[model samples]
Target: MKNILRLALRAIGVWATALSLFSAGGLHAQSFPSQPVRIIVAQAAGGLVDILARGYATELNRLWDQPVIVENRPGANTIIGAEAAARSAPDGHTLLLSNSATISINQFLYKKLPYDPERDFALLYNIASSAYIIVVNPSLPVNSLREFIELAKRKPGEIAYGSFGLGSSSHLETEYLSARTGIRMTHIPYKGVADVLPALARGDVQMALAGIQPAIPLLKAGKIRVLALTASVRDPLAPDVPTAAESGYPGLNLAGWFGFVAPAATPRPILDKISGDLAQISNRRDFKEKTIMRGGLVPLLQPPEQFAEYVREERARYSLLIKNLNLNLD
Candidate 1:
C-alpha cells in the first residue's frame, strides 16, 4: 500500500511541476500584440474578400494601436492561402480571411485538402453572409422566379446558365436548384465572374447566379433582371427582389459567408478580444451602410463556439450536397 501511494504522490508532483512550466491559451491575452498583426487574405486585391480584409485590418490597427497588414495570396481556389494560414504560428497574430470555399466546400470539391479547416484553425467570426441573385436575360418573358422556372421546365436543357467555373458555387447552386425543381439548364463555365457577366449580358447564357455587387451594374443598365435571391430572406438593398424561399422553394438557401480564422491553438482569450473588436466594427452604423449594406449583405457576428458550430453544420451540409451532385472538381 505504501509503495502504491508513493507512486501516486510522485505522479501528482510531476503534473504540478509541468502545469507551472508554461502558459497555455489565456495567460498572455492582456498583452497580446507583442508584435504587429498580419491578416492573410485568400483572394486577390480589389475583390470583396480583400476589401473586407483591408477594412477590418484598418479598424483593428486603430483598435490595437499597432500596424495590421494584409497579404494577398490569391490562387488555387483558396488552397494556397489557407495552407499558409494554417501553418502559421498559433500566437493570434496571423489571421486568415476565409470564405465558404475554404472552410466548408473545399472538402467536397477536392479529394483532399492540404490543411484540415476544422483541425488546423479556430473560426473567429462570420463577418457577413451574401447570396447569389438568379438573373435572367430581360428579353425573356420571365420577370419573376416562378415564371423563369416554368419556362425552364417548358424548354428543358434550353435555358443555359453561366458560372464562374465548374466547381464554383454558381454552378453547384444551379445544379442543386435544377435537381430539386426537376428542370435542366445547360452549364456554361467561365474563368471568373468578370468573364461570365458579359456572357450573361450577351445572352450567351440565358441566366446566372451572380453576386450583388457585380450584378448591380448590369441591373442598373437594364442588361439583366434579378429574379430571386438564394438567401432565405429578401435583401434589404434590393427589397424588390424576393428570396427563393419567398418564391416557393424553402430549401434553396445557398448563401455564401465570409469569416476570419486563426491557427487552432490560438488562445481563447485573444480570440475573444478579436471577436469583440470585430463586433464593434460590425456594429458601426456607418460602416454597415457603406460596406455591408451596399453589397446586399447583413452582418452576422457570432461567438467563437457558435461560429465553430456553424462551420461544422455548413461543412456537413455542403458535403452531402456535393456528393449528391457528384461534383468532384479536383
Candidate 2:
C-alpha cells in the first residue's frame, strides 16, 4: 500500500514539474522582448542585408511594442558579427541577420572560426534570396551564355573574372562555371560585391558574377551585359534573363540568401514566437514591396524547421564544393 502511494506521488510530482516548465516557456514567449531587441547584421550599413534587417526591425518593433535595433558589425567576412551574436545571451533578445556566407560557406573557408555555425546558432527564418547573374564587359564579344563559354574557352587564361573576394560565392560560382564548361579564366579578387561590378565595368576585369540588384544601374547604362543567371528559374525582377539551366548549365543554380538566427540555447517557445512573427511580417504586402522587391530580392521566407533543414543542406553542399575547389583560407 505504501509503495503504491509513493509511486502515485512521484508521478504527480513529475507531471507538476512538466506543467511548470511548459507554463514557464509559454510565459517566456508571451513576454519576449521584455527588453529592447537588437539584430546584429554582418554587413556594412545601406547594403542589402542591412537594409532588410532594418526593415524587419521596424515591423518587429511594431509587433512587439518594443524597441528593435539593427547593428552592423561587418568585417572579417562576417566573423565579427557572427561571433558577437553567438556569444550573446541565449535569451532570443540578440539575433543575427546574416547572409549565406556566415552560416554555410565560412566553415569550409576558414579552418578555425570564433563561433561554430552548427553548434552556436538556431536558424529562425530564411528571409529572402537574390539571383546571381553572370555579367561581362559590353566590349567583350559575348551576347549569349554559349558565346561567353566559347570566348572563355578560346581565351583560356587570357579572360579574367572578378569576385567579391577569395572563396566568396562569387568566386566559387565563377570557378564552378569554369570547371563545368572546361574553360579557364583569371580570378581577380576584390574587397566586396560593390567593387566587383565596377571593376568589370571599367574593364579592370572582363567578367564577374554579381547580384542583379547592384548590376541594374550598370546594365541600364550599357556598362555590362548579363550572360546568364546562376539560378534555376528567372527572377520576376529580371524575367528576360535566362537561368543557367535554360542556358544549358543546370549545375549553377545557387541563389544568395539572408536569414535570421539566434543563439542555440534560446528557449523553444521564444524561438517559435520570433519565427512566427517574422514569417507573418515577411508575408505582408508592405514588406514585399518596401523591403524585398525594392532590393531586387524575392521573399523566400520559410518556417523554422524548413529553414534549419535548408541551412543543413546548404552547408553540406558548400562543404563539398569548397573541398573540390581546394579553398583553405585558414
Candidate 3:
C-alpha cells in the first residue's frame, strides 16, 4: 500500500508540472507581441528580401495591432544581421528573414560562424522563392541552352562566367552546372548579381546565372540573352524562357528561397502562433498577388515542421556540393 501511494504521488507531480508548463506556454502565445516586433534583413533596403520584410511587416503590424519594424544590417556576407538575430532574446518578437546563404550554405563555407544554424534558430516558413536564369553576352555565339553547353565544351576554360560572389548561390549553381556538363569556365566574382549583368553586356564575362527581373531591361535591349531558367517550371514574367529541365538539364533546376526564423529557445506555443498567423497571411490572395507576384517571386509557404525539414535537407545537399567543390571561405 505504501509503494502504490508513493508511485501515484510521483505521477501526479509530473502531471501537475506538465500542466503548468502547458498553461504558461498558452499564456505566452496569447500575450505575444506585448511590445514592438522587429524583422531583420541581412540585405540592403531596396533588395528583394528587404522589400518582402517591409511588406510582411505591414501585414503583421495590422494583424497584431502592434508595431513591426524591418531592420537592415547588410554587410560581411550577411553575418552581421544573422548573428544579431541569433543572439536576440528568445521571445517571439525578433525574426530573421533568412535565405540559403545564412541557413544552409554559410556553415559549409565558413569554418566558424558566430552562431550555429541549427542550434540557434527555428524556421517559421519558406515564404518566397525565385529562379536564376542562365544569361550570356548577346555577342556570344550561343542562343540556346544546348548551344551554350556545346560552346562551353568546345572552348573549355576559354569562356568566363560571373557570379554574385564566392560561395553564393550563383557561384555554386554555376559550379554545379560545370560539374554536370563536364565543362570548365573561368569564374569572375562580382560584388553582386546586379553588377554581373553590366559585365555581361560589356562582354567582360561570357555568361552568368542572373535574376530575371533585373535582367529584363538588358534582355529587352538585346544586350544579354536569357537561354534558360534554373527552375522546374516557367516563370510567368518570362513565359517564353524554358526551364533547365525542359531544356534537357533536369538536374540544373535549383531555385533560391527565403524564409523566416526565430531564436531557437522561443516558446513552442508562441512559435506555433506566429507561424499559424503567417501561414494565414500567405494564403491571402491580396498578399499573394501584391507582395509576392508583384516582385516576380513564387510563394513557398510551409508549416514550421515542414520548413524545418526543408532546411535540413537543403543543408545536407549544400554540404555535399560544397565538399565536392572544395570551397571554404574561412
Per-residue lDDT over 1-330 for candidate 1, one digit per residue giving the tens place of the 0 to 100 score: 999999999999999876754444456777878899999987656556667788789888998988999998866667888999999998889999888888888878887789987799888888887788889888789888889989999999998898756566667778999998889999987654666778889989989887787678889999988999988777777878888988888888877778889998877778887878888897899887887777666677776778888888888888898989877876
TM-score of each: 0.82, 0.86, 0.86
How should the candidates be ordered by TM-score, best one leading?
2, 3, 1
Q: Point to the candidate with the largest lDDT.
A: 3
Which residue pairs in candidate 3 have backbone atoms (N, alpha carbon, C) closer than 3 angstroms, thus clashing? none
What is the overall TM-score of model 2 with all chains considered together?
A: 0.86
lDDT of 3 by residue, 198-275 (tens): 899999999998767768888999889999998878899899999998888888877778899999999899999999
Which whole-number lDDT from 0 to 100 does residue 183 have in model 2?
96
The lDDT for every candidate, in the order shown, is 0.82, 0.85, 0.87
Question: Candidates sorted by lDDT, descending order?
Answer: 3, 2, 1
RMSD of each: 3.3, 2.8, 2.9
- What's the lDDT for candidate 2? 0.85
Report the lDDT of model 2 for residue 287. 79
RMSD of 2: 2.8
